[model samples]
Target: MSKAEKTKQFIIEKTASLFNTKGYLSTTLSDIAQATHLTKGSIYGNFANKDELAIEVYKYNSGLLSKSMSRSFGDEFPTTMDKLHAFVDFYRKNWRSVFSNGGCPLMNAATESDDIFPGLKNQVKKSFEDWAGKISSVIIQGQKNGDLNEKANAEEYASIFIMLLEGGILLSKTTGDEKFLNLALERITKMIDNELNILPS
Candidate 1:
């Protein structure tokens, strides 16, 4: 890559966590400069303005989460049930190392940018739609393979799963207790095993 491209990526990488943690409006160019060790002029040279920079940083943070979930779903799990379980496992295992850095970038962006940043709010919405689509597709596949109950509504189940998981994360972070998250995951597990999974006749 060219120097300009590399420099822009460096700024994005450096400021992604800052934006996620401190938020879009709360985070200023000065904070980014401090985090990236770049001059204000350099930051402005790479980005048009704070809004533009925040948009890119939000994308970067969201991509990190998407990539992690994709890797866990694709690499470590074989069956559909296993893949679903992997979602819970991914957050459980990486809450400290990965999630706590920013605490679910999509959720953070959605909550922080909803009223202020229209562009970011829309992106967050798209992220949720995309995630729900993925989960629904998996459920459809599982039903076709006779691994999951054919009667289960993929979209409905996907929506509930996302809500429960994200709510758990929020509660866990707010209360400084991992048990809330674990409880949600445990409930999801039971739903998967008892409600979604096909049982012998």
Candidate 2:
């Protein structure tokens, strides 16, 4: 890789957590400079402005999260039900790591960018759409395999699942109680077993 590209990536990696924790508006170029050990001129040399840098940082943070999840839901989880369970397990097991890293990047960006940064907000919206698409795809596969009920609405279930999980994250983070997330996971498990799981004839 080119030196310039490496430098840019270094800046993104350094500032990603800062942006996730302090947020876009609150995180300044000075803070980024301090975090990256780069001069303001260097930062600007890579990014056109703070807005551009923030957008890239959001992508970097989100990409890391997606990669972690993908790693958790590996090829060993062949069945859709297995994959879904793994998804829950991933969050449950990694909650502490996530909390220490400043919470879910997608959630942080969505909540912080809305009504403020239109570009960033739209990016968050696209991120949600992409996430829902993945979940819905899994639901459709489950139905095809008779692992999940054909009567279930894939999109609707996906939306509910995301809402419950994200809401649980928010509540758990706010209250410093993992029980809130566990409760949400319990509900999801019931939903999968009772609502989506296909019954034997």
Candidate 3:
């Protein structure tokens, strides 16, 4: 890659944790520079502005999540139930880190950007749609394989799964009870498994 591209990625890598932990609105260019041992000018030299950097960081974090999940659900699973379990397991592994960082990026973006940054909000919406598409595709694959019940709609299941997980995280964060989120995850995981078993077997 080019020097500019490398610098941009460096900024994103250094600041992704900051953005996830402190929040996009709360993070500053100086914070990223300090974290990366670069100057403010160096950061801006790569990013036109902090807003641009924040958007890039959001995308970067989401892409990392997708990669982890895709790896977790690889071809060896060969079934929809396996993929669904992989999804739940990934969250179980990451939810604490995500919550400590002020909860999930999508959840934070949904709450934070709604009133302040329309552009960021739009990006969050697109991100959700993109993630939902991946989830729906997996569910459809499972359905085709007769692993998931045809009566269950892929998009609906995907949306509800996300809602339950993110909403649970939000509440868990608010209440300061990590168990709240884990219990929610466990419950829904059980439900999803039960539903998965009911497929036309």
Candidate 4:
């Protein structure tokens, strides 16, 4: 990539954590500039405003989750149960590493941007929709393969899964309890394994 493009990516990467940790309203252009070690003029040259930078940061963080899931899935097709398990396992394993003390960026942006920032709220909506669509697609595929019960609704299940995960992340972060996140994962994983899997008698 060109130097200018690299600089823009650098700014996004550096400031994403700030946006994730500090919230959109709390983080300032100066904070981003300071994090990226760029001058105010340099930052403005790349992004139109703090709002634009915040939107970019949300996208960058969401892209991280997307990339991680894609990387973990790899070439082999996972069983319906394994695919769902894989996602939970990834989120559980990466909760501290990827999220650190910041928590899920999508969840953070969804809660913080709603009723606060219109543009950012739209981006978060799109991100969640995209996540749901992917999960729903996997569910439908599993149903077609007879691995998952046809009675189960893919979109509904996907929405609930995403909602629970986001809520768990928020709750865990709000209460400063990582164990809440683990408990949430445990319950979700069991649901996926038991309800979604349907073991033979």
Candidate RMSDs in Å, in order, are 1.2, 1.1, 2.0, 1.7
lDDT agreement with native, every candidate: 0.87, 0.89, 0.80, 0.82
lDDT, candidate 3, at 38: 94
Runs off by more than 4 Å, candidate 2: none
Ranking by lDDT: 2, 1, 4, 3
Residue pairs clashing in model 3 are none
Supply the global lDDT for candidate 1.
Answer: 0.87
Error of 4 at 117 (Å): 1.2
Instruction: Estimate the TM-score of every prediction.
Output: 0.96, 0.96, 0.89, 0.92
- Find the number of clashing residue pairs for candidate 3: 0
State the lDDT at 103 in candidate 1.
Answer: 86
lDDT of 3 by residue, 77-175 (tens): 767787788888887888767766667888787787786978788889998998788888888887787777778788987888788888788888889
Best by TM-score: 2
Query: Per-residue lDDT of 44-155 in model 2, one digit per residue for the tens?
Result: 9999999999999998988888888866457799888899888888888999989888898999999998988998999899888988888888889889987899999999
Which has the better TM-score: candidate 1, or candidate 4?
1
| Clash count, one per candidate | 0, 0, 0, 0
lDDT of each residue in 1-201, candidate 1, tens digit only = 999999999999988888988988899888998999999999999889999989888888888788888775684578998998887788888887655686888888899887789989998999999889988888899999889999999999999988988999898888888898888889888998899998789
- Model 1 stretches with alpha carbons more than 4 Å out: none
Candidate 3 wrong stretches, greater than 4 Å: 199-201
lDDT of 1 at 176: 85
